[model samples]
Target: MKKLPIILSLLFLTLCCVSCKVGRFVYYNLANITDYKIFPSRPLVNDSIVFHYYTTEQDKAKVPKKINYNGSEVAFDDFLADNKTVAFLIIKNDTIQYEKYFNGYEQESIIASFSMAKSVTSILIGCALDDGFIKSVDEPVVNYVPELKDNGLEKVTIKHLLQMSSGIKCEESYINPFGDAATYYYGTDLRKALSKMKPEREPGTEFSYSSCDTQLLGLVLERSLKGETITEYLDEKIWKPLGMEYDASWSLDREKNGLEKTFCCINARARDFSKIGRLYLNKGNWNGKQIVSENWVEESTKPDTGLGNVDYYKYQWWLSSGGSYMAKGLLGQFIYVYPSKDLIIVRLGKNYGEVAWPELLTSLAENY
Candidate 1:
């Protein structure tokens, strides 16, 4: 009977170890929090692309040290400090205006894009549209993903996914281990993970932010190409043409033929990420060559009326009241573009305190 006690003790230790591991995983993800970091990403190489350098002539004009925030004035220095900003860059008229790096981050350091990858994925969809791989944004997702033909997902279209109005029942809670977001982030089989999802409402009826919409779009992109990997397609179409200075990486769910975590977690340099803004600012023309269609650029950035009352989201890009669009990621990664002023601002940081960024950007646009 003494063996019963020892067996019970062993089982308890095993359970404790398992619980500890799970706890560590949740703590590291911190999906519920706004200040979590994305790590352990895979490399997305840019081998054939020649480096394209931005014309560098630093402007010495001092940015405003203070701006209004929530009926109170807040210093920009304090904003950076309180928000744990690691890098801040500004490019105006194709010239580097102000550039600074903090927290030991250098120009060459690769940072995670978190949800900014959604914008990139949307760009890929544009490229696919241009290539005729995708006939139109109005096409049903089930047309490409035959597995979802019988499911209720057939009602969803590419436009709905891009606008985050797919109406899928995928909860974007990162903290819940059993939630759809966690499963898509950590699960091994993305196809299986996506296949199980069903629409909770009529597709495109209302706007709802869910990462699963983007993942489904990624699958459609993959299936449309028939056999091309997203990394390869990205390198061939955008990365090479945009003249990216550094190679970027996209994280995958598994090692062999694993699907990219397309909804988030693209690792790239701050400067290279700015190229995207430049592309849109120039109306999809890069160095006199058209990359993405001008029509697509206009359609993607402007607010979609189909999203109902939500005017902030448009084709995976975030829209502001001033008609300026931005690519934002978790934990304060932002690439703000103002085409009217030929201005682009890139901010990479660990966290951003509750500061009025739109007001700050607008002020900078007006002043500069």
Candidate 2:
């Protein structure tokens, strides 16, 4: 009977993990492009309305299809396929100039764009501001999510979260199972998990790329929504208005009426994601119906370093010095827009795969 106690202890620990996110983390290994497949999600359903892009034979433009990578010349399509690219698209003048799918993916297949959801959340925030759900950017987050006041987040403004300058600290690593990333990504109760969060310093001093800042923005949005879920808000403001061709989903911290992870996890198909790039490319107007305010879109994609912020990141969108910007995510998901060329490029990959994607996109926008 000596081994009975030890066996029981091991059994207990195993059960505890099995009942929680740790078991999921162990099963999934590191976060992957497929993480959304295993998580409980909220549906963003579409109505009968749909918008089709303008296309023509002449709309498709030709460009350099061969490039030297790693000191060897390879076909650009082969290079993309070998480098884990699943879906790629180039849209110009509201038409799909080029579209390709590799690795057994199709236009109907779903891919999770982690952190690209941050830009979408910022869009919703802008919508809320326009709708009077949120007063202004300068308003403190505690005004919406009063629960955060206990963590000394009262000084943190909506702008701080949008700019990623909120000094509130959480471990940013995605590979660590016990870290905040895992806790927020896989935990069952985000409401409960949030109370454990504490600020590393006072608000809005230096730029820090923390997913926690984005989740806090999600929480603030949730509270201010007033009897509506975040998913519903997105559908009403974006999906329906943009006439997204396929239905998409947003990951939640739990299965039923749970808080959206909101820092990440907007599961969608590649073509549908292109519409986002298209939206910003036209400065947030979709077919003459303003989706988000033009002023908001300009503020989001513009490069600014003032107020302790980085020039490359503004309002949850990434900017380049030459007036290009993108919504980027882990595992190489991108919705790149170059307004100067009237081009929008979308790439969804399993991983970055030894390619500096931003530079490549810049080259394509400039030369193609």
Per-model TM against the reference: 0.87, 0.94
Which residue ranges in model 1 land beyond 4 Å of their true spot? Answer: 1-24, 31-42, 47-59, 65-78, 307-309
Per-residue alpha-carbon lDDT of model 1 for 1-368, expressed as tens digits? 99999988876765564334243345455542222133334455655655454565444544556766667778765666566777787788777777777767778887888888899999999999999999999999889887886677878889889988888898887677777877777666788888887878988788888899999999999998889888788888888888788878787776778787789878888888898889899888988898889999999888758545278889999988567888888777888998888889988877665655656666677677
- Kindly list the per-residue Cα lDDT of model 2 for residues 156-230, writing each as its tens digit: 899999998888878988888888888898789988877767788767779999898899899889999998999
Residue pairs in collision within model 1: 44-249
Error of 2 at 156 (Å): 0.8
Q: In angstroms, how far off is 14's CA in candidate 2?
A: 5.0
Whole-model lDDT for model 2 versus the true structure? 0.87
What lDDT does each candidate get?
A: 0.78, 0.87
- Evaluated at residue 179, the lDDT of candidate 2 is 89
TM match of model 2 to true structure: 0.94
